[model samples]
Structures are given as structure tokens and as C-alpha cells.
Target: MSLDVVVVGAGAMGAATAWQAAKLGADVTLLDRGQVCGGTSAHGVGLVTRLLWEPPDIGLVAHSLDRFRELDETAGASFDYHDTGSLLIVGPEHEDEVQKVFRTWRAQAIDVRPVSPGDVAEIPGCADLELAKAEHAFFTEADGWCVTMDAVRAMVDEARSHGANVRPNTPVDRVRDGLVRLADGDELEAEAVVVAAGVRSRQLIEDGWRPPIDAFRAQAAVLGHEGNRSGPIVHDTPNRTYWRPEGSGQVMIGDGTDLSSHEPGLEPSVDEAFAHRVAERLRDRWPAADPIHEVRSWADLEAATPDARPLVGRVPDRERVYLCTGGNGFGFMRSPALGEGLAQRIVQKGSPVPLHGCEPSRFEEGYGTGFPMQEGFALD
Candidate 1:
């Protein structure tokens, strides 16, 4: 049977998309190459916050956060959301940039607050705080993270109950004549196709249509702690490192700069040097915490665009095909709002968010007819 919508990849974004589409009365089917939520969606730090510095992204982030708040009541499962708050410490080098963000957020009336070193140091696990030497910091008491795997599972379950079919270990080879062809000779016919295949999206395009997505391998370390710090998400912008309380006895520490994308088909692996470097940074920041008990890590490539924003709207060349990939590293955080917005556009025939700046056509229009590439290199 031809499905109303066949979503590729069952990560957070794909799962959320399928759930929304199915919930809205469309027949949906979700396909994935491996276990559900095994991709970057599972590996994400789950920072679900709308405290964005960019004005354009503020509404979308806010929408995502709001949706997350309603998930348990609507979707029948709690995604393990924790509103422990978050902090962004600014260094001398980033003072100007930080101030600019503050000014813009304040102008827009966001709940962003500028703070001093002493203010940040008072938070738990931040006793030996470096704020006194740091430049500035920002806090959003309303921010937090969702349990990544649980969120995906809940969405999938809800979508299935709503008549959507989600299949794992079903690797899609390509799309031909408006149907998704599998390697084992199965075909999925659909009225529309939405590609939310994380980094693997780089390879699933048509013969001539490729997105300028670069795969960056990112890794994070899970530190075990005894007590949950009521302290907000502890972050040091200069070190590109952040620590957030996880469950009862653990904290998740990740370095933002531990990113280095590789070519397509490159199996994700942990960068020992980078991981160790980040661990050292974390240790230095929080000397009170015990040593990392079990360090679990994975590498996933992010679809990065030249301008650092995602190519979120419809594909320019193909009318039936839509492009929802290239979320960079913020896909999970942006998925709640972004997925719902995409669904609204697909169902209503126009974007709820402004498409003038985010359209995939902009790349072709600005680049003069070349396929989207990273440094002009093709995905294959």
C-alpha cells in the first residue's frame, strides 16, 4: 500500500516528524538502517532549551521547548526531561560576541540574563569557579535536556498507535520513480518523502542532487557523580566544555569543539586525543567530582552547511521531495519546533517559519548552479 508519507531515518527528528504526521491523520511509515534511536539522536546530550542568542531561531527554539513540555501529557510517556537550567560562560575573547547576543536577546525580550563570575561560581559543582577570571556569562533558568532514547521511543510508539508503521534495520538504497527501493528488492511507495537521515542523508540524494553537508565526528564523556547538583548546566565557553546533571548519580560532560567531520561512509569512532582533552578540561573545571567511572562515547557525523544553518525547507528541484537534514549539531534541540513546523508546512502548503532565508534554493541561487558540497567535495 502506498503510504501518505514515508520518513527516512528513525532518529529524534524523523521519529517526531512521523509522529506528528501520523497524529494529524496521515498514513506514515518510518524506516531506519539500524535500531531505532541508535544514531546521533541517541548520542545527543539532550539539551532541550530555547535560550538562543539568534533572533530568527528564538521562536523555533521556544516552540520546541513548549512542545517538549506537552509531550508527556499528549504522548503518554515522559522523555526524562530535567529543567536544571544552563549557563554559558564567556571569555575575554568572546566578550564582544557574548554582549552582542545579550543585546539582541534583551531587545527581543527573551529570558536571558547577563551575570558575573561570582554568580556562576555559587552554583553546585562550580565551587572553584573560574568566573572571576572569565569575561561574562548568561543563564536561562528555564532550559534543560530530554532523555534522548526515551523521547524517540515515545514518539515512535505514539506514531504506531496512530497508524504509522515504523520499521528498523530497513536500509533504503535509493529513490526511483517516486518510490523508495530497498537493497533486498522491497519498495515503499508514498505520496511524499521526507529525508531526516542525519549524516547518512549525504548519500541518499538523486544522481545529480546532493546537499552541501559535511560529516563531523563528535564525542562526549559521561561522568558519574553521587549527588544531583541543583546547579544549572555548568558551561565554560572558552574551553567549549559543558557539564549537566544526568540521573541520580551521573553527569554528562561534553566539549563543543570535539568536532571533526569525515567523508561519507566513514565509520564513526571516538577520537582518543580529543576525548581525553575534553575530559581533562572537565576535570580542571570541576575538581570536586569523582573520576569518570565508565566513559561511553560514539562518533556521529553532523550535516553542516556553509552558513552553519540547516537546509530545512523543501528541495528546490523536486516538488514531491523535501529536505529536512543538515541540522549541524543542534538537531535534537531544534527538532521539537523544527519538526512540527515542517509538518505544518507540508500539510498547509507553506512554512510557518520564514522560508526566505532558509530555503534550499538559496544555495543554488547564490552558488550559480553547483551541487551543494563541503569545500566543493561531493559526499561520495
Candidate 2:
């Protein structure tokens, strides 16, 4: 059956879009290259922090957070939805910049406040930590992590039950004339098509319209910290190593700067040297954490536009074709808002929130130059 809307890419945003669209009484079909939970969605750090620069974006992410709370209650399953909050440790040189972020959050009335070095130590997991040499730090009451894969699966299942057709292992080739052609040469026609294909959405449009959404590789080590007392997600700004408890007795570690680049569909290699460097950094920062044992890793191309924001809104010169790629380093946190904004455009013929800053047409109109290449890295 022909669908009213055909959504490409079934990651977090795609799944959320399909589920919400179906809930709004639209006949939707969601297509993913692999399984729904694969790709960037599953690989993300699952930080659900509402700290954002753009006010409109905060609304959408906050919406998703609200849904997450509701879904957790309804499903009676914990996606590890921890409100343990987030601590952004500041360096001496970067303290002012961090304050700028805090002031911005305050102006926006986000639930954020400054924490003294002493006060910061009182928070769960941060207690008794050495902060004498530290600069400044702030804590947000609105940040934590979630089990991304399970949430994506639950949303996909909910959409399917609402008569939305979702096909895993069905990667779409491209869209032509408002029709989406899958890898198997199968065609599905619809009045509107939403390109929520993550980093891959850039290549779906014609050549000149493509943005420089660079694809980069990033590897993380899920360390087993035998006696982690830290209650919140812990991050050290200077070293750029972030550690957070994964429940029970295990904690995960990833270097904020240990990201690499890759071509489309090419598997990523775990950098042993890079991993060792990260381990060394973590050891110095935490001091009491257990040694790294085994590691499990996967890779996918992550796309980011030049401006460090996502390319959302309609495709240029295409009737009813909307592009929702380019979440850059902020994809997972921004998925809820992106999905809602796209749905508003599709269902109501106009998005209440202005997407001018993130519209794909801006790239086409030369508002921002393109960094078109085989692949690039995210800037988060």
C-alpha cells in the first residue's frame, strides 16, 4: 500500500518520527539499512542533558525527555534513565567559556546552576575528589544517560502496533519524484518523504545540494570500575575523558577527542594506541578505577555540517521532500525535537518552530559553504 509518509533511516530520530507520525494518524513506512537500533543511535553516549544554546531546540529535546519519562513508566523498564545530572568540569583557561554556557542556560531558564569545587564534590560520584587545582564547575539538574538501543526498539514497536509499517534490513537507495527506492529496487510512493537518514541523508539529494557533513570514527571502552561511588556521569574537561557508572559495578570511558574519520559503509578500526592514551588519562583522573579488560566496539559514519548544527527542514527544489540530517555532534540529544519539528511540517504543512537556521536550503543557497567529501568527523 502507498504510504502517506515514507521515512528513511530508522535510528532514534527516524523511529521517533515514525512513532509520532503514526500516533498522529498518518500512514507511515519506516525503512532502515540494517536493524532499527543500529547506526549512530545505538553508539551514542546516551547523555540526555537539556543544556542547549537554541531555545527552540530545548523545547523539542525537553519534549523527548518528557516522553522518555512517560515511556519508562508505561513500559516498566529502565532504559537506565538516570537523573543523576551532569557535571561540566571547567579548566582554568576555559572557566569563562563555561560560565558563558551557564549564563546562557540561566537566561533560557534551564535548570542549571553553579557548583563550587567543594559543592561539586558533594554530588554523587564526585564526592571526595580532588578539586583544589580545578577552576570552576557547574551542574545541571536536567542531564543524565539512557539506554538508547532499548528506547529505539520500544518506539519502533509502538509505531508498528499503530499500523505504521517498519522494515529492518531495508536500506533505501535514494528518493526520486517523491518516491523512495530501496536497495532491492522496490519503490514506495508517497505524498511526502522525510529524509531522516542520519549522516547519509546528505548524499541522498542531488550533488550541488549536498553539505559537508563529515563522517568520523569514534571508539569507546566500557571499563569495569569495581567500586565506583560516583552517582552522576563524571567528566573531566582538561583530560577530556568522561566516565559514568553503567549500573552494578561497571563504568564506561571514552575520550572526548578520540574521534576519527571513515568512508560510507566502511567498518572502523579500534585504535589501540588511542585506547591506551585514553586509559592512561582515565587512570590519572580517577586514580582508583579498575584496569581496562576486554573491549567491544562498532563504527558508523557521523555527519556534521560546517556550522556545528544539524541540517533540518525541507530539501531545496523538491516538493514535499524534507531533509532531517546533520545533527552533527548533538544528534541523539536533539532527536526528539527534530522528529517533532519534521512531523509538524508534514502534518500541518508548516512547522511552528522556525527551521531557517537549520534548513537544507541554506546550504543550497550558499548561506554556508559545503565541505563535501567521502567522510568527515562530528564536532561534539
**Candidate 1 local lDDT, 1-380, one digit each (tens):** 32488889899888878887787777888999999998888887777655555666666667777777777566654555667777777678767766776787667666778777777666555565555455777887777777788888888887898899889999988864347888788988777788888777757766555666677766677766444455677666666776677767677766656345577577777776755676667656666554646456666766677665766667666766666776767777777666666766776666565533556777763332122433211001
The number of clashing residue pairs in model 1 is 2
lDDT of 1: 0.69
Where does the lowest 10-residue lDDT sum fall in candidate 1? 371-380
Top lDDT: which candidate number? Answer: 1
Per-model TM-score on C-alpha atoms: 0.88, 0.88
lDDT of 1 at 22: 82
lDDT of each: 0.69, 0.68
TM-score of 2: 0.88
Model 2 Cα shift for residue 69 (angstroms): 1.6
Question: Model 1 — TM-score against the truth?
Answer: 0.88
Candidate 2 per-residue lDDT over residues 1-380, each given as its tens digit:
43398889888888877877787778999988898878887877676765554555666567677777766775565344667887766578766566666676777677777777778767777764556456676677667777778778877877887799988899788776578888788888988888888767766655445555666665566655547565777666677766666766566666646334456557666676765776677666666665654355444456667665677777777786877777655577667667767777777767665555777765545443234322111113
Stretches off by above 4 angstroms in model 2 are: 1-3, 52-60, 78-80, 206-208, 258-260, 290-298, 353-356, 365-380
Task: List per-candidate RMSD values in Å.
Answer: 4.3, 3.3
Off by over 4 Å in 1: 1-3, 75-78, 122-128, 225-230, 290-294, 354-356, 365-380
